[model samples]
Target: MAGTATHHGIPLRSGSGLSYRFDPGALGFELLPTGGPDWMARYEVLHTPEDLRRWVGQSRLDPTPEPEIGAEDVPAARALRDALWRIGLARVAGEGPADADLATLNAAAARPPLVPVIGQDGAAGWAAPATGAQVLSTVARDAIAVLTGPYADRIRICSGDNCALMYVDTSRPGRRRWCAMENCGNRHKVRAHRARQSGE
Candidate 1:
């Protein structure tokens, strides 16, 4: 999870050893890598309360909160994540998300989210002893915002081969196509270059 020097996003390493930044452009999309529904279960990383807490720490949540995680929170988090996955992918495909998936997101969003407060030092911080439910509620709310907001039409799946990662095209021109220019984008460029050379 080394941070990419040039990108304002999470760093990820491919199986082939290519490391690059991955900005899902929204917090909710971050949960996709923890695992997914059905066939994606093999990538499961949230197996315990600590695992969920670790994810929270690594997430893009600014001024990260140390939530009081409980055993039950793990399954709840997974359910929300799975719902997000389905909904996000549906958006990429220009299809409507399932009613059940929407229900799950709404349910999570209904919970109390993390309470933000100013510290004595005049710094922004979360209220003490936040619960995992609160953290999840915040994530769900973010998903709702991204799915229904102005950039809703900008949702895109990376065009890189074998890459299913989703991201919002926040670029000014909205022409972004890969998960990261240093990774997939570079690979695509190299392949195209080699193809041209061989044809010559």
Candidate 2:
């Protein structure tokens, strides 16, 4: 999100038990002055720190600070997660499948920025000394790998309310519910109880 670059098209929204579809504008992504595709826009929407805090719940990973989470971080928590899900599914569904998506994410995240790799014979073959994104699309290749990597079990969508966010549940049983524990899950539970009372 910090980069000058922007991605085109809507990031596909997916879920395990159910799916919800809404335009990007519904989540507050706004159109820019320049002409572009329907989903292209500047965004007013993002996850608040509270949103994320509720999302992770009592997971093994410790909570991040309670600051104003940025517009940039939004994709990581929501769209990026869904994107990873798609990428993982596609890669796994391919021939000779192996789950290396988690590895891809770990390896990529483990890296620093790209430095140059010099070749012999005075020809420069651009290789980043590390696993980070390059000027070319090797970054995308790695990204695909990360999403479909061996840790596929950890990736899960929330069972809370009608939320459309997904997350990596690093729990012991690998079972997680709700996009946020205190709110989304609770709301769903309450709704269920009320429905039983009224017989929906």
Candidate 3:
């Protein structure tokens, strides 16, 4: 169901005040925009336990796991997300993921993931009061699946200039480009129009 859905809607706002939904196409790649290591620290959004909780709610995790996020979970999430960023980029470049990053993912995946159960209403649900570790574990496991799955070769960096968002191109023709057509794709169209007008 949720996991098998073609896209997960992540609400985002652009510098120009445009709001749009970004579908990174997988649970793990969704973590990358929260922040990363080194220069990416500027984009840091996982500031508090609540912040992490909020993100989990916003994430594609079906029947979202209400993990008891702690202060320590914050840094751990950032670390995992940064590692994922490196791994994703490496895949895009046709290079192997680094050992260190692989180790990080493996360690997280070793932990028990969020427990799922069917509710009385037959709706999907997660075991109550999950741990932060479980949340990370779930994300790591998802990453592992995508990395080793058929679409692994379809991972791509957005073609928009100055945009570094990564997404798995799951289109049947595999010709999908841009993070979102309404966002980067439309921007490219506008730029081309302006250039044409200038040349006239």
Candidate 4:
């Protein structure tokens, strides 16, 4: 199925529109789709430390004790995002993941992810005290899980026009085309309608 519906409008051009959605498939693939055909104008969602913080917070992987993201974490976060993108693309192509990308991911995975904490009331919760690296590690580990698991075969790139995002096809029919119906599906539909009218 497509992602949750939102009112975010579509931009015909690349690197202008920014839509964020969480798919039930994988977390690592979510880092992509910020930019499109234009590499230069590609809008990076996590452009600042605060953006990283918001992304992680919204992820809900480690909610409490929000890790203080600093300038140093931004580059690492970007690098990790790129690495995951490359790995995801390779998975979709039925090709081996790049050795360098694997190495980078492995290194990130080596770091400890969020650990569960038991409250005094016996209620359990998870937290990553070292937010920066731990959060990034968590994302890397998620990618690793997806890439190595059976779902890796379901990896698909969105077929939306000018949309270059990867997603895991978890539908029953396994024929999901766009990442989200509200995001690109509607745009495709409108464009097709315009074409039909123009042709007639």
Best by lDDT: 3
How do these models rank on TM-score, best leading? Answer: 3, 1, 4, 2
Worst 10 residues of 4 by lDDT: 1-10
- lDDT string, candidate 4, 29-95, tens digits: 5555443223723566767889788766555354566776788887787777777777777777788
Clashing pairs in 2: 99-149, 99-150, 100-149, 101-145, 101-146, 101-148, 101-149, 102-149, 105-146, 159-178
Compute each candidate's TM-score over C-alphas.
0.91, 0.35, 0.92, 0.77
lDDT of each: 0.83, 0.36, 0.84, 0.68
Residue-wise lDDT of candidate 1 within 1-200, one digit each (tens)?
11111226765778698776788887878778788998878778999999998777767765334789999999999999999989988888889999999999999999998887765676565787789998899889888998889889998988899887788888889899998888889889999999999999
- Candidate 2 vs candidate 3, lDDT winner: 3
**Number of colliding residue pairs in each model:** 0, 10, 0, 0
* Selected candidate, larger TM-score, 1 vs 4: 1
TM-score computed on alpha carbons, candidate 3: 0.92
TM-score for candidate 1, residues paired by index: 0.91
**Clashing residue pairs, candidate 4?**
none
Residue 189 of model 1, lDDT score? 100
lDDT of 3 by residue, 3-102 (tens): 2223457777766889988888888888887878777788889999998888887778763446788999888898899999999988888899899999
- Give the runs in model 2 whose Cα sits over 4 Å from its true position: 1-150
Clashing residue pairs, candidate 3? none
Off by over 4 Å in 3: 1-8, 63-65, 197-200
**Global lDDT for candidate 2?**
0.36
